[model samples]
Target: MQTIQALNQGAEAVDGEGEARVGDGTKVWLHWRATAVRNSEGKIDYFIAMFEDTAARHDVEVAAEANLELMQRLSALKTEFLQSVSHEFKTALIGIQGFSEFMRDADQLDLNDARAFASDIHRDAERLDRMVTEMIALDHIESTRANLRLSAVDINAVIEHEVAVTKISAASAIVTNLELKLPKVSGDEDKLSEVVRTLLADAVKYSPDGGRITVSTSVADGTVTVSVKDQGVAARADFDNRLFGRDELYASNPIRKVVGTGLGLGIVRQVIEMHGGRLWVDRVDGEGSEFHFTLQAVDASLVTPGGGRVA
Candidate 1:
């Protein structure tokens, strides 16, 4: 009302500009404009008032704000990731240096004692090598996504092989309940195998004291889904309802004690996506977490009557 009165008194007023929801529950941002008209005698005559719908502009502003927030989060996570990587590298180097020094001062030690030192050195070197190799693999996955090798590969066979490998040194008891007749999926076999390996390894890593790890496969609505469940500690609060960022896996809480670059699941996710599939944490904050992913199942028509590939 004051704005209207101001316009009537020969003064123009353009106020009350913001957003609101109308009776139909649609949101709109309004930009109010008011102008006072004058007669020949310079006396105020009438007023013109206008409202412009600025909803689209307001939406753009909202989107920009969200983008800024996300960029900020990514920046912070990157710093954390670099720090974690540094710590891992330093630990490996320290082990190598310490064991070498011990060998230099143990000239009189027995042959068995000398072999133990060599083993320690080899173990540390392997740890460092694995770290560098994984970092390279992540870069390759990100840049060469379009070059993925496509073929009809058996997902069950991939699961079986990965489970056997993980059980070799896994403290946890690994088990599989695979559907043998499940359809093959079209994807890069090596990359798909890495996905399975990473998930199983992650399960064992989180359950250091040994627990049950189950790998399963199922089909529904033309999608082949695989799940890896572990009986480990529940995920931290940050990962309960959201996916972990690259550095989030190294969060200074419970996971800080767990050894990883925190990029394992992240890499797994991108690979699944490259195969036109999606991966997610199906269950968390429970007895343990279950990681599930889907891939396009090979069409039934593509297989011969004898359950063999048409080719």
Candidate 2:
């Protein structure tokens, strides 16, 4: 139709580009050009049209655009990761340095005051260690170099131990609602323990004013789910997907109030995945957050009246 119109209007040439499906049902980019061939009387005549397949060039252009976008995303992630690491390190270092300096130069430090300062320093040091450990653990898992001592792990025992340890340091009250006679899971005890610990610590850290943290475990369809619910500042709806992502250390909302390297949750996700499980978080009644993860439940009958799995 355009070719006929161009010819009737005496236009010298008409050109356009569009996408078309080929005989193989594959879409391809095409460019067409139509030229008017006039008669000796300088009147209307037939038009000649030529079509060129531009799929190859189009593919190259699209690939280049995708690569550019990927590079930009990677650059942004690097910047954010560095900023998060620097902030966490600086905060811990400041606490350690201030407490050490105060203890060193104090004219008459009482026994209780000295002990408190030392405890503060130790806590800061431990935080620094934990941050470093999480980074390394994530790296190892990503590299597939992590050696997991997989076994029939008692999930309740891991949760109970982590909750108890967290209660000692957490200002919030930690409660557990573990199911009895729960089936064991095939996972590394140490790694599972770290997962629980990370979740509990996050709960305590976010619940700055000391709220109740409930840790619960349940089983369904050969999967055991553990949830850590915290009555703290709820995460934004948009930030839910990025919560376990290593690239996003903190959200640009109320969740950023708590200081963290953001490596803990990422590591938890990796560990859970390595154990053939999944992890996720949800808003608790629009006022708090509940982090949950699932592990493959082992059959109860596979055990020989003991905690170990039978071959």
For candidate 1, the TM-score is 0.59
Count clashes in each candidate, considering only residues at least 3 apart in sequence or on different chains. 0, 0
List the global CA lDDT of all models: 0.73, 0.74
lDDT of 2 by residue, 29-134 (tens): 9998988888898876667889999888887787667555544544454455567778878989999999999988999999999999998898889878877875
Tens-place lDDT per residue, model 1, 54-80, is 888887887667555544544454455
User: Any runs in candidate 1 off by more than 4 Å, and if so which?
Assistant: 1-83, 94-126, 208-210, 240-257, 283-286, 301-311
Any runs in candidate 2 off by more than 4 Å, and if so which? 1-80, 86-131, 143-146, 243-257, 301-311
In the order shown, what is each candidate's alpha-carbon RMSD? 9.6, 11.2
